[model samples]
Target: MAELEPEARDRIMDVFMARYNALHATDYDRFEDGPKGTDHDYLCVSSSGKAPLKVQHTRAWADPETEWRVPKDVERLIVHALQRRLDERKICDRHVSIRVDSFPPKRREKLALLEKIWMAVEFGLNRDWSNPSLQRLMRYERNDWTQFYQPISPYVAELEILERVPPVQAPALVGWSATGEEGDGVQDAVFRTVEALKKKEEHYRGTSADLVLVIDFEVMPYFQDELERIRAALAARSIDFREVWLVSQWLPVSADQVWPAPNVQSADAP
Candidate 1:
């Protein structure tokens, strides 16, 4: 895995602190970069004048080697290209969904594939099923938007049109691909989290401030039960971190505490 730049690392810490504060109802305000050669990554301070915490952030990947195999920028390129075509055609009333089976590695091939997709969508929209029998069948199954299956290439597989319920100022395209490995993904998540914990333990050992390990689950698939298994695995190992947090950077963003055993009640508890 490549090392995170100082600025990039700070951005991750910023998001982590925002979510952490919301989750725990704490007043942590900001963080600063730790001194060079220090064990921790940043020193997070609280607005309420509590002791500052030394935070160490790390990312875990199911398969680090293939994490960047498909460049996200390419996906964005496809969306933008299609959006421009939609604007040119005055298709501003609905939305589009694209399911990609694979993407060509070459740039020219990708551009060609995009053109074919737009042409197919255009043709499908203007096509008139004039046969009396077919027209009768269409009346019964009328839809707000048209759908098309364009086998443009091995790269681009399917294209679907969706009617905007409330209508929109402009049409939008949502693109997705099946990039996850087949499985429940619990074991992979657990293995990645545990590996990250082990690697950070030595770096944060014997530190005066509290140690925090933040695991990124943006690409890794998991659920609540996966968190339980991860917690159990970490608790069995002797580690240095005071707390462990799992963070997701995608939509419906979340930050969860997986350490300190949430079920373990304090002796002074009521």
Candidate 2:
């Protein structure tokens, strides 16, 4: 590879580093400007299809009773917000697109994913980008090349990789599924419960419980580990977590204060 000039090398490194950050930052909300102190942001989707990508931010959260629409212009905003965020880190390339059906439940899941990419971009946009730092981080730079054209060596690529770290969200209460003799029915119920919790959690992401414990006939063995992983991931981005619990068959001994819901809403309810 031809050696890159000093200026060219600096510019390329800046682009690489900024892009790395935007993809992993804890802040995931596309509408929100700048990074939130906590790791991870809640993504809201309106199932009614009332909210378009271009839907106004205020309208989306207008009232609990009113259904919000995603506006048509959301794709453009996603790209714009992402690019602007990426630019802050000195990344010049704004070219990007969403793959098909990334968010399956969403009417425009692809756009949502695109918007997510922008949100990821926002996480890494505001950081220091300097050539000397790059050289130290990269460990390999073309010293023989002329000022106009200096190339990055192939071996040096590995060094650059070392400096890159995955963005993390800490102690997240992801989704849940029940397993046992009542696997199907229990799982279905848990899914609905988690979805409800997710909606409520949107109002508060970082300030609430980061752990969700469901006392059930059978709980997944990896549940706690998974939650910890989420916490580590969010910690990288400074996001917090809130925990939720679903109790089935038997409640936790310590959860004497917690109570189960009455069976008023049946599964077949229209």
Candidate 3:
């Protein structure tokens, strides 16, 4: 693949930063100590630098003008940014730290709706339904029609901390929940694998070296929005890696230089 132009890289970074804001939305007003006790922004710090790279000291929901286009859910937005970074093959070693907390009441409600819609849609398409009518009801739930509500959350937000990992150890890391025909196959698989990896990583203190792999599966485009939300969800989690790589048939190209990605991991056994 060809290199990403500086403009493209900037756009990718913008997306990465905004996505992080969306994912880290939490309830800050509810904190008794106010903003100090609450993590109102997506906090990213590069510890290696003499001074940290500070993007802004503002919340994803607030701008000088009106609020952001996206309502801002911490998990959904951050993961979306991270996923974009991975898709572009931009994995850095900049000792980056991300913290998403402090959401408004409405933002919390929006997140719940997004998650519920996503799960409902995923179930309708991926799981078996003896009665198609019930499945349809779940897909077209009542709350879906409410104002300021959407089936999927907008994949945008604010940028707090930005750090680019070094050029070395840029191996890609693409995680998918592997659930589909066999009860939400790819999504389930990827979710299970990540959960297991998380447990194992914590268990071994991040010392496992097994080449991650996935079984066969397919998903309909009917749930593209849901998939995007799911991707955002996974990205929000602060998963660590020394030299991680993400490989997928959907986006086989690591052409997005802003992501700092290495070669793709093979689906077949290495």
Candidate 4:
């Protein structure tokens, strides 16, 4: 997983605050980046002149190892390698997007993975597009782009190939999944959430301001059950935080309150 750029991080905080204000009927409208090397990420101030809240954002990863592996770097490596191959072959007929399923852990295996992906792309290009079943998968409205699903390659899980629209200066590989693995469901979410909370609890102990732990769900899939499971897990432990929120990265964005469990009210509950 890549570190969020400052602008991107601020934008996510803005979205979370918007949802938070609407849900809680609070007027938190201003935000400032917390001092560098501090315990919190941002200081949020309300219109009512209430004390600024110390907010810290931590993303929940389905596979925590991604922080070190850096999946985005792998995607860039694949894209650059594929583009170079296309240029070498002088084959600029279409634009393709690849969804990687898995990449080998070892360096030697990764080199082999690139070759396998190119082979899969070449196979997809030569595929009979006029076949009835294949034609059904075409996006007629979107430049007649056809999808090729997992073409016998362990590396390339999906390929979206667009043809007969417009010739470009170069063929491009446009999209890839954040982490190729599928979500492990609510239990995984609960575990990750608890892990994030515990990590933050240890780091930011005795901070004066109210803490808002925002669990980013961009890399991890979101499920309704995750909310209840997180609430239950939090109730079982004694953690220090004024609020806990689950924020989604997808459209129609949502920030769900997960702490202050309805069944187990905190002494500080208003």
lDDT of each: 0.61, 0.28, 0.30, 0.64
**Would you give me the overall lDDT of model 3?**
0.30
List the lowest-lDDT window of 10 residues for candidate 1. Answer: 135-144
Off by over 4 Å in 4: 1-3, 23-25, 67-70, 87-175, 178-188, 205-209, 221-226, 262-270
Report lDDT (Cα) of residue 252, candidate 3: 21
Top candidate (lDDT):
4
Model 1 over residues 225-264: C-alpha lDDT tens digits?
6777877898898766778877665544556677766553
Which pairs of residues collide in model 4? Answer: none
Give the per-residue lDDT of model 3 (tens digit) for 157-264: 111222222235543332222111233123342353244335534644543232111111112111222333334444665544321222222222111110112233
How many pairs of residues collide in each model? Answer: 0, 42, 52, 0
Which regions in candidate 3 have their CA more than 4 angstroms from the true location? 1-193, 207-227, 249-270
Stretches > 4 Å off in candidate 1: 1-29, 33-41, 46-51, 63-71, 92-94, 130-153, 162-192, 195-211, 219-225, 236-242, 249-254, 260-270
Runs in model 2 deviating more than 4 A are 1-105, 129-132, 135-270
Per-model TM-score, in order, reads: 0.59, 0.16, 0.19, 0.66
Clash number for candidate 2: 42
- Predicted candidate 4 versus true structure: per-residue lDDT over 1-270, tens digit per residue: 135787667667878777676666678898988888776778888878977878888877645655425466566677778777777777655666766555677877777777766765776566666643342222211223334323325555456666533445554444555344344223377887887777777777756237788888776455665577778888888667888877776664556778865443211111
Q: After superposition, how far is residue 41 of candidate 3 from its true place, in Å?
A: 37
Question: Rank order by lDDT, top first?
Answer: 4, 1, 3, 2
